[model samples]
Target: MADAPPPDATGAGKRRGGTSGKVADFRYKRPAQPEKKRRDARSGHERSGPERSGRERSGQASPLPSQMRPDAGAQSRAGSARRQAYAALDLGTNNCRLLIARPSGENFTVIDAFSRVVRLGEGLAASGRLSDVAMDRALAALHVCAEKLRRRNVHLARSVATEACRRAANGERFIERVREETGIALDIISAQEEARLAVLGCHILLEDGRDGTRGPAVIFDIGGGSTELVLIEPGGPVPRILDWMSVPWGVVSLTDSVDGPDGTAAGRAARYAAMRAIVDKSFAPFARRIAPYRDTDEGIRLLGTSGTVTTLASLHLELPQYDRRAVDGLVVPSASMRDISTRLSTMSEAERGTLPCIGDDRANLVVAGCAILESILDIWPARDLAVADRGIREGILRSLIAADAEGERSREELQRARDVTRSGASL
Candidate 1:
């Protein structure tokens, strides 16, 4: 199926930093202060706010202009030409990623990007706290992120720490230390917000429903410390999130719960079954809640964003090495995924690691991820699975770009109002 249209800027309108799913008018409100201050209600220094500043990205729809004072119009267009670069940083349980880009047309162009698997939540599952080793590894990755932001001269940025930071007992302390050490503020967002952003960033890749298939689509993000599943009703500027749920079971967490080593084939299978049972139980509530949506005439549309799906998709394609271009947006048979999951469960960590995509870093954890994916597939029963290389970071960029455009629109409106007043006074 062909891809859906990229989100239109007008459709996005003025949104705080998170979910803007409402279908009503999207009006841009100019902030009272030039630099809008973010309030930290829980932690004194933890900053949280709607992304308020940045220049708009390219490829977004612009406001239709009426007769304007030529000078003011020219000035506004010229100002837009001086595009400001924006950055979005997502520090998840297993990886730290950064993207720096400037508005291109309706979308943006990536100027610089960075990604590293630091396993920030490595020991959080068993210890219930971030280990010193894990923290140190994460900080090393963040230090690199900070330098990139500095060199890029980012005009606006939003940094977020996900499941690892959200669940670990030392999460807050770690956030504080990150600020003190790297000069980066990390917002530990709720799982609900996390799901929304994942959908926002990747929904464009959803394939249109085929004949005999229509209705709400299932979009999920399988992370290191947790997994987020979202049920969205498609059609419109943005898909409306009808329901969502987050389970504590993720690759790291699930792997931690199971035994240390894969001894025999039977032992590995048992461990895999145990992992599936854990996820299935966690997903039961959400599965029941969304059962009605599944009964619709349309086929179940499922899209997944995470290392698990990407890696599995890569294996399914028989890629000698990992390739983002070939994997992202690729759709595969659900049976194929299930077969791969079952196959991986039987193999030892060493054997799985030898494969092109599942290296040493992911070897121990991939089994847990496969278990979670199978559980999701079991409940949703989508015939095909869609893969997304983009997620929270991409979503953040879209939000920042939309917010910047809203600000510009508001300023234009104000300018037009002032011009009208002057014209009346002259008359």
Candidate 2:
């Protein structure tokens, strides 16, 4: 709730102090929709009434993603009122991903999706600013998202930039450029909000705790520039956040910080050890705080939502290629995960690239991810590691939909009250 930084030369808000935080952008691009609709969505936004677009009548809506299904009444609902579409864009240090969805009953159905590894945080740990090349890559990806938003006529949308933007000196400058270029505002969310969103998005996949005695669950999101670890008390509509911490030691940051030759076994081991030590130190405070949970009757339930865990889960499944249906919601043994991490940590980048899921895009960085994962295991020692492909984007969509629902209910109530007032006046 603090005042945003003052505008600098670039017209983007300038950070006063060297603070480590993030910004997240929320937008609703309605190129095809009416100007009033666009303006309204920008301020308070649309309600998810059954509003059908031309495309829906034409049966041109994009198919839902693998994780979601179309309800039987989806088509009927589309005709009721204005079908308000929502979009969530997550521009992280390592990847640019976008999801566009429409409310379908209690859940939203994804209409379109896009993902590309832009590595916006590349060299950020060393440079303390977003490099031109990285920014260009991210902008290119955002352009695609912008186009999609326009074509989909997204009524409610939010685009968030994580660790990379949060850590860079010119983060706001780049955000301004993004807004000017793509008409998409990028919000660099704080670490705590990032952690909360990640948990909200993926915690549904947590294995039932009622099967046995349940302990507090641990949900961690390993991003490109930073990693977030959140502890929660389960058994509620949504897990209540017990405690959490965000460390600036994700794949890109860790790998850049501890650079060495990993082509050889000895070299890889040495570099991996360095990475672990750094993460261990970064996580020491959180570890000490959660020491009590380690001794619970039922050990910690750990759920991970990030490219790191998904890639590892793919490797565990020995999939021919990355499959979201197979990887998402998977429960892998902790020991097995540790073994995979160790094996991957030792393998040279080239060797790792040759594997099924850890291709060239993830070759060099997977080792750092492994190190972080291992350090997590060392602390929270969970029996099983649950994998989630969903995170911030899903969380954003859910929030937008929930807000829309509330707005819709309020509108209905107001209408009913007006109807009663009119009747009384006529009487």
Q: Which candidate comes out best when scored by TM-score?
A: 2
Please list the residue runs of candidate 2 whose C-alpha ends up more than 4 Å from where it truly belongs after superposition.
Answer: 1-82, 210-213
> Candidate 2 overall Cα lDDT vs. reference?
0.74
lDDT of 2 by residue, 306-407 (tens): 889999999999998887878878889989999999999878778899998777888989889999999999889888888988888888777766665565
Each candidate structure's count of clashing pairs = 14, 15
lDDT of each: 0.73, 0.74
How far off is residue 390 in model 2, in Å? Answer: 0.7
Per-residue lDDT of 222-305 in model 1, one digit per residue for the tens?
Answer: 998889888888787678777777887789889988886548998998999899888998888888888988886666789999
Give me the runs in candidate 1 sitting further than 4 Å from their true place.
Answer: 1-78, 210-212, 422-427
TM-score for each prediction?
0.81, 0.83
lDDT of 1 at 49: 15
